[model samples]
Target: MSDDGDDPGRAGTGEPAPAEVGAKWARDRRNRVFLRRALAGVLVVAVVVVLGFSVRTSRLTDESGAFGPDLAPVMDRIAAENAEVEKNHPGAYVTVVAMFPMTGSLTDIGLNRESIRHGLEGIHLAQVWRNRQPSSPPYVRLLVGSDGPDDWEPTVEAIKARTADEHIVAVTGLGASTGTTRRTVESLSGSGYAMVSAVITSDELTGVRGLARVAALNSEQARAGVVHARKVNPGLKAVVIKDLNPADSYVKTLARFYTGSLADRERVMELSFDSSTRFSGTVLDVIAERVCNSGANTVLYAGRSEQLPALMQALSQRDRCVRPGMTVITGDDASEMNRKADLNMWGDTRIRLFYTALAHPAGLTLPGGEVLTAIRARFAGDDPDAFPRVFPHESLGDGMAIVHHDAMFVALETVKAFAREPDVPSPQDMANMLTSGTVAVEGASGPIRIVEGGARQTKEIPILQLNPDGTSAYSGRITMTDGGPGRS
Candidate 1:
């Protein structure tokens, strides 16, 4: 090769390499370093995304998480189903609060409300809520007031506080007595919610707009008893031996209705009972004064069954001793009377004690019986029967299961209605739907339609009369001769 000292292509040329070549070399080195760093960063990000996704999926699908030991297995299943429902359908929740009865003469009404009647109906409602939307936020909470065998004040206060902060739409309990329930109802009135009661039997709950009762009204029961008595004994004379004290509002109402400007008005005698003599000499002295002294052949007992033993004790002490042929009719169930205590009606077949059942007529059957059977089958070990067994009357057996099934149906229907409506229904909306006279619901008792006054459908009450053998049977069906002001 020639020396060519000025040639650019020469190894020791005075000129540098081409600008493009120099730039390409530097760019290749930088690109290699950048590629390595970018690859490392991408790998780190990939790992983080996978971990986060795994955590989120686990939380959403895992049954072992979130709900602690407090929820029953059935409740857990319901909750899971509800979660799935809410996931699919946003902005939907079902909430239930039970105001149980506590401390009062009408505590028996509480037992019937909690275990046998309305309280049990509430639990069934949860199942209904879940069934309605098995994959949503089963927004159901039961704040059981500590009224049954415990102090319910704390529970009541806690719920009251929660109500202020939260959007609770419907309420349905505290069926202690009309008074206790009324205390609760009055507190929640105008808060815009509906309360459906199963056993608070007081007729006073009518026309409150948001309150509905599932139990037969006290006035209805009294009228049924009177009609049944009259049907069985045409010669019956009316003598009302009522505890005219303030505690017995049912008696007061009955007195007003029975003595409503009738020609036989003087036949009705009003007796006053005080704290000193609840079922003592006061009740019997009054009974003796009305039936024995005044020649009243038939008498009506409007007091509690607990008072019955004392009344009988006093009657037995009398000189004449509940004279024969003295036909007496009472509203209390003789079958539920103390089996050991002598009611003294054993020989006198003319004397009768009556009561009404909240049962449905024979022909009507509840919906979803087969579905309930299947649910029980799948959860045989888990006791799906917990809600249904609330009404444990073996006499009717499965026939009585209609009560719970119908309650569930009502709850489910309400949930569906809430879901489809343009507005997310507040509690009051649900109450309105339930209490609206237009909604004819088939309930556990019978074809339940809330009349304009918020009372359940009136069934033909069967009059059970006690026989000399200490057993009772339905003498006849009782009908309401008139719908009085006390009735609504």
Candidate 2:
């Protein structure tokens, strides 16, 4: 009983027997090995997860490297084309970048592509007229592409890279979406590149330096919509369907302006849906119930072109809201309502539909009218029906196309004016000149005077109504004096 391994005396001695001590050390060694292996496995998993994320991010944001296709070939083509123009005319060639949304939620209906074609045509026509005198004909090289949606980081990176490497002096063409144009301006403004938008009407961009918009402001459009709604129904009860695309703050802003502009006699019910949401039967039923309960005789859709068709279909199916004398109002995004599919949606509906836009060719009267007529005449020589093709939908007759033309005209004129100086101003200087409100140019949209603070001083927005027979006719015009909303 006194043996060291078995006796209690060993425990009281403050030292274990040799066999017991060896066993205890072995147990501690096994636990340490297990912990080390567990930590190694965790580290391996963490590294793999990080690498996967990095690859995904690289593919999304990196355009210059192998992660995405480089736009160098496109740039080369533009340069080659400009070089040919210079070879014939022998003038100082100035490169202008045209950034279009070729791919995104904005281009779902092919309007962006059509806009690109029209914008390029406008630039080329201006070049031909300006190049008549070989003394200093400006040859414009356009770098065009779609900046991806959401962050548009890929397109922004490509633009920055091209601006640095290609010597781009000015940029145009951000399409109709406010979100796209805002992100684009923010990206290029830092680099001192001047930008012009064809149809971006966000009030938020009013005072942004280095950016000028040719279209009417979103607030102006909303005011026009309210004016037209009240005209159609003196005591209008309206339900507004707002497309809540976080990227496009303009829609929400327009809705707010519309609500605030309403008179005490009028009542407005506001409802919002994300542009990406696909409305199901339950959702549509809820919307229909809301519209019915609100007793709204007019429905205003403030959203993109793609969302309108589904919304119209959903609302039309609800008998309560699809009755006679109901009025539906929309903005320029619905400019293509004459398209085959969209036209059919309004074919038998008893509700009246109207949209607001700049002047149509049929009714456009300004000093710039002659310029557009000349350009259209030249285009007609090649194809008499080119106008219809450019603006296939809506009877507005290439009104949006004319806006694009005006955008190019403004950009070219600005650059040409700067070129006349003894020393060409830097990009920032040119931007300052534009935003200074001193630069007044005759554009297809009429006399475009960029007022101090970047608002284009122009009057006249046409409201086109869709007849029951599926044809659009001019309803009225909204004219702004001193940048305040007034309908004529």
Per-prediction CA RMSD (Å): 22.0, 25.0
In model 2, the number of clashes is 1
Candidate 2 — worst ten consecutive residues by lDDT sum?
1-10
Model 1 spans with C-alpha error above 4 angstroms: 1-93, 104-143, 147-156, 163-168, 261-268, 275-282, 313-323, 330-350, 360-412, 422-424, 466-472, 479-488
Which regions in candidate 2 have their CA more than 4 angstroms from the true location?
A: 1-83, 89-91, 107-112, 133-135, 150-155, 158-167, 280-285, 336-338, 365-398, 467-471
Query: TM-scores of all models?
Result: 0.62, 0.73
Please, what is the whole-model Cα lDDT of each candidate in the order they appear? 0.46, 0.60
lDDT of 1 by residue, 136-181 (tens): 2224433334343233444444555555223345555444343445
